[model samples]
Target: MPELRITTLIDAPLRTVAAALLDARLLARAVRGLGVRISGGPVLFAGATLDGSVGPVDGTLFVTRADTTGVSAELVGGPLPRFTLVTDLLHTGGGTMVVDSVEWSSPGGPFGRLADVLVGRGLALKVLEARAAAVSARSVELLSARVVVGAAIIRDGLLLAQQRSYPPEAAGKWELPGGRVEPGETDHAAVIRECSEELGVTVEPDDQIGPDIPLRADLVLRVFAAHLTEGEPEAVEHRAVRWLTAADLDTVDWLPADRVLLPALHPLLT
Candidate 1:
C-alpha cells in the first residue's frame, strides 16, 4: 500500500469547512479528471455512495464517515484495487488546517506497481490538490453565513412542534421552534433564547442533532435537543404547538428545512 498526503489552510472555522466539504457537487468538480464530469450522488451524508466514471474506468466513492471533524471516503471498483481518502480538519489560528490523505494499492503486480509509481501517484496528488482548492474557495463564502438554531424539545417520548402563522407560503406548516442566531451569540444561547421567545418556556439545550441543513447560500439550520426546565410552553409566536410521537412525525406538513431532519429526530425519541 502507498499513501499520499497534502495539506492546505482555509481561512474559515472548522464548522464552515466541514459544511463545505459535504457538498457532493463540490466534491465531484474537485475530483474531475481529464475532461471527466463526475455526477450521480446523494447529499454526501455518511454512508452515501457517489458513482462516477472516467472513460469506462468506473468507481464508486463511498462516504464512510462525515462530521465536524472531517470526512473519510473509500473508492471501490476503480483502476486501483484499494483507495481510501481521508480528510482531517484542525482548528488553527483563526482558521482551519486541512490535511487530505489517500491510501491506495495498485493492481497487476510488478508492472502495475511501476505504473503507479510513475503515473498513478501524480494523478492522485492532482486529485487531492483539486479537492483542497475547491473546499477552500467554498469555505470562504460561508465565513459570514448566519445559522438558524431549532430546538427539538422532547418530554416523555413526544417532540415539540409548532405551526407557522405568518408568511403566506409557510402558514400552517410545522417546524421546530427557533430563529436566527444573533451576532456574537453562541448556538446554545440562541437555542435557549428562541425557545423562550417562541414557545414562552425556558429550556435546557443539550447536544445538537442531525446534519446542518443549508437554508440558503447565506443561511444554515441546526437542530438541538432540549428539555423544559421552567414554565409550561405556550404558542406565543406560532399558530399552534403540538407534541408528536416519533410515529406521528410524518403526519404533518413540515417546513422543507425541518423535514430533512426527520431521520435524525427519530433516534432521539426511540
Candidate 2:
C-alpha cells in the first residue's frame, strides 16, 4: 500500500476549526480547486458522498467518519480505489493542529510510490494541499458565529421587560430577559435556563415570537413567548423588571434587538 501524511497548524480553536471542515457549504466553497463537491447527505452525523475531478479521474469520495476530533474518507468507484484519507484535529497551546493521513495500494512493488507520484499527481496530492490551505484560511470567518436567546413573557395582558443593570452599552435599556445558549442546550432549554438565572423564575417557552434579529455582525437574538411557571419574576440580574400593556410598549427605551420585535410581538400580547 502507498501512503501519504500531511499536517498543518491552524490558528483557531478545535471546535471552530472542526465546524469549518465539517460544514458542507464551507467545504464546497473551499474544495473547489480539488474539484471535490459534497454530492450527498451533509447528514445528521455530517456524512457526505463527495464526487469530482481528481486530475483526469472522477469518482465518489466515501466518508468513513466525520466527528468532532477527526474525519476519514476514501476515494472509490474508480480505477485504483485510489486513496483512503484520515484527518484529525488536536488542541495544543498555540491553536488547533490538523493532521491528515492517506493510504493507497500500488500494483508495482517498489515502483508503486513512483507510479502514484507520476500518475496520481493532480488530485491526490496537489488538490489535497490546496484543500487544506483553503480550510485554514476559512477558519477566521466562522469563529465569530454566536447564538443568543431571549424570553418575552406575557401575563395578565402585559409583556414583561427588564432593565439592564451592567454592561455600560446596555445599562439602562429595557430588553427581553434571557442569555447565551450554552453548548448542548436547545433554544427552549436555554430560555428556561436564562429565566432561572436572571429572573429567579421558571419559564416555559410556548412559541418563538419574532424574527431572528441580528445583534451584531455575528450574534443573533431569538425571542420566545414564555409563561412563568414557578417563582416570582425578580430582577436578580437586572436593575428592574416591568410588565407593560401593549399600548404602553413604546414608552420604554428598549435594547435595539429587543425593540425590533415589538411589531411582531404586538398581536401575541393581550
Candidate 3:
C-alpha cells in the first residue's frame, strides 16, 4: 500500500472552505477523465455515491463520513480499488488549513507495485492537486462576495414570516427578517441585529438552513435557523407578521429569494 498527503492553506473562513469542498459540481470539475454524477444525498454526506467512469473503467466514490471537521470517502471500482481519501479542515490564525490524504493498494503483485511507483503515484498526485486548487478558488470567490442573512425563527412548530411594505414591486411579497451583513459583523450577529430592528425581538441564530443562494452578481443570501430569546415579535418595518406551519408555506407570496428556500425551511417546523 502507498499513501500520499497534500496540505494547502486557503485565505478564507473555515465555513467557506467547507462549503466549496462539499459542492458536488466543484468536485466533479476537479476529477479528471471521469464524468461524475451524483446519486443519492450530497457529496459529503455519508452514504452518498459519485458514479462515473474513467474511459472504460467504472468508478464509484462512496462517502463514508462527513462533518464540520472533515470528510472520508473510498473508491471501490475505479482504476484504483480500495482507494481511500480523507480531508480535514482546521481553523488557523490567518485562514483555513486543508489536509488531504489518500491511500491505495496496487492490483497485481511485483509488476503492479512497480507500475504504481512509476505511473500510479503521478496520476493520483495530479488529481489531488487539481481538487485542492478548485477548492481554493471557490473559497476565495465566496470570501470576497457580499452576503445577506435571513433568520428563520421557529417556535411551537410555527415559522415566522414577514410581509414587505416598501419598494412597490416587492411591497406585497413575504420574506424572512434579515438584512445585509454590515462591515466587520459576523452572519450570526447580523441576524440578531436585523431581527431586532425589523421584528422587534431578540433571536439566537443556529446552523445555516440551506445552500448560499445568489441574490445579485455580488450578493448571496444565507438563511439560519433561529429561536427567540426575548420579546414577542412585531412587524416594526414590514406590513405584517405571521407564524406559519409547514403546510402554510406556499400560502403567502414570498419574495423570490425566500421562496427558493421553502423546501429547506419545512423541516424546521416539524
1 or 3, which is superior by lDDT?
1
Error at 181, model 1, angstroms: 4.9
Cα lDDT tens digits for candidate 1, 170-212 = 9999999999999999999999999889988999999987656
| C-alpha RMSD in Å of predicted model 1 compared with the true structure | 5.4
Q: For residues 145-198, what per-residue lDDT tens digits would candidate 2 score against the true structure?
A: 677889889898889999998899789999999989888888899999999999
Tell how far residue 171 is off in model 2, in angstroms: 41
> Taking the candidates one at a time, how many backbone clashes does each contain?
0, 1, 0
Point out the higher-scoring one by TM-score: 1 or 2. Answer: 1
Tell me which of candidates 1 and 2 scores higher on lDDT: 1
Residue pairs of candidate 3 with colliding backbone atoms = none
- Model 2 scores worst on lDDT over the 10 consecutive residues at 38-47
lDDT of 3 by residue, 154-225 (tens): 999999999999999899899999999999999999999999999889999999876565454356778999
lDDT of each: 0.80, 0.70, 0.76
> Cα deviation in Å at residue 15, candidate 1?
1.3
